[model samples]
Target: MIPLQRISVSTRTQTLLTRWTKHVQDTGATTKAARAQWKKAKAPKAKVRTALESMARGAVRCMYCDDNRATDIDHFEPLDEAPLRAFVWLNHLLACSYCNSNVKRSQYPVDADGACLLVDPTAEDPADHLELLLKSGRYTAVSGSAKGEETIRVFALNRPDLVKGRMDAFSRACSNMRDWHQLCQEADPEADRVAQALLDSPFIDVVHAMTRLKPSVAAVVVGPRTVPALDAWRSAHGF
Candidate 1:
């Protein structure tokens, strides 16, 4: 999964959150209250969704799988588990229904020291924990990091469909980069369109993985001709 950057909520939303959280903290049915407030707090939810959509990568994709379009505001720390953080912006992330509701519903794994074993893409780089094999579109934990392993298991990051999606995305990237390069070679202004096409493609982490691949390795997978275009796009975007 690609890393995500968190953004701010509006002042009114922030104030609403503070009020809701304080009430929850003071309530007898804290989790219930949080849930109730979440349903009632329409304005805050809409603004949070907007902020997350802007911060989201590749057409507002899920922060966990980065494959499906994000539609749910997931509690990074599940509301049931951490009621106090229910309205906290920092504890929120955009996710797809499959990942948020079906796979990772309130599943928060932790180590013996109480450290989070699940990798939060917003808090830390997922690549540090998980090494994505570009060709196979499978994720293997870097040095078998527990966090990476858990994240994969929890989200089914290497599920067959997901793997195939990633592999297909890589293939598309290679073809797209070649087109982008052709436009750039001719100094065509429309190269921007191809660049945007690359961005619009699903499973965008493939571009990042290819860019970071060793020159000799990348030559074999993404091809020697496509490398320059990928690099140029990456540089132009300041990624």
Candidate 2:
């Protein structure tokens, strides 16, 4: 998983959240009341919605699958068991619905010694424990540890459809890279234009996959020395 940047909420949303939090803390209100308070405290609703959007900026792709559309707020620990952490921003994550539903909801982490097996995309790099098998498009555990196994199991990285999708994405990306290289070798002055054309191509999944294989290529083509922008572009476009 890629690193994420925490976005700050607007002043109005912050004030509303603070008041709602206080109400929850002081009165030990029902979940319905808490939600209602959060909703009713703000006017226009757009400010709160914008604040939620801000909170989602720079989050990594889903831990499980590749349906990277708009992300929903997810609880690291289930709200029913960890009620105090329900509204805690630190325990919240921006995730795709597919992953949130298919593999990860309410799945509490296992403890092995002092280690936790579940992958926390916000806190750790997934590449450290997970590696993509190019042939099968499945994620495998390079490290022989419970954490690695747990991560794969929880994410369903070996699922057939997911593997096929990743492979297809990787294949398309390779083709694009070859085409771009051919364009670059043409000795034309419009090399940058050609690069931009590749960026605007519909097959961004391939672009994202190629970047994972050759970061330098992405640096040259995308021209932004940052990973977040590339990731965001990939997710936003369903690449």
Candidate 3:
């Protein structure tokens, strides 16, 4: 999962959420009971979904896997588990059907000490807790963070199809970066255009990591194992 900026929603929507939350709190209902009420009410209509989609960078990809187009809004704090939080705007994330329905449907695991273990991409940087293997496109848990492990398990981030998808994205991004490097060598006017294009590429984070002079968390996750041409370009340009 990539770090995402929280987008602003209109005051009208915020007011609605604030009012609903007060109503839920006034009833003194347990989270489970509040969820039951929500199910019957069918709240968070189209407007809420639209705001969430905008938060997912126009719903270009799932916030969890970052491998497929996001098609649904997932409750970061599952409704049944934390019903008062159900309609809260900050608790929403955009997800693909496979990640939301097939894999992570309402499965909220907690650590032995009872802390929620899943990563919330909006609240934290995933690279701080997870590592990506370039060759296999699998995620590994960073020490001391249960967030990374549980997220991978619940979301099936290492499933074969997802691994293949990541590998393809990585390869394509690297190829583009290589082209950008060659153009830079001749001081070509087109070099800036290629650089901008890299920002728009799928899995563009890998290229961002490659171009930095210092080792970044993203670079450590995918590298220290070098692609020779890409490494040479990074060394020359990043310095």
Best candidate (score: lDDT): 1
State the C-alpha lDDT per candidate: 0.85, 0.55, 0.71
C-alpha RMSD by candidate, in order: 1.5, 7.3, 4.7
Segments of candidate 2 deviating more than 4 angstroms:
8-15, 27-64, 112-115, 186-239
lDDT of 3: 0.71
- Assess every candidate by TM-score: 0.94, 0.65, 0.76
Q: Compared to the true structure, candidate 2 yields what TM-score?
A: 0.65
Regarding TM-score, does 1 or 2 come out ahead? 1
Compared with the true structure, the alpha-carbon lDDT of candidate 2 equals 0.55
For this target, which candidate reaches the highest TM-score against the unseen true structure? 1
Per-residue lDDT of candidate 1, residues 96-147 (tens digit): 9999999999899999998888888888888899988988999999895999
- How many steric clashes does model 3 contain? 0
Give one digit per residue, the lDDT tens place, for model 3 in 1-239. 66777787789988877777776787775776666556654455465777766666322678888767888778877876887886788888888999999999999999789888898878887777777766566778888767888888999988998788778867776676667667877789897787666554555444533454244453554444434446655655441
Task: Single out the weakest 10-residue window by summed lDDT for candidate 1.
Answer: 230-239
> In candidate 3, which residue ranges exceed 4 Å CA deviation?
22-44, 57-59, 184-198, 204-239
lDDT ranking, best first: 1, 3, 2
lDDT of 2 by residue, 119-232 (tens): 675576556676665545667786776666787787676777777776776555555445545555575657456456555443233344444645555555434433344444
Q: Predictions ranked by TM-score, top down?
A: 1, 3, 2
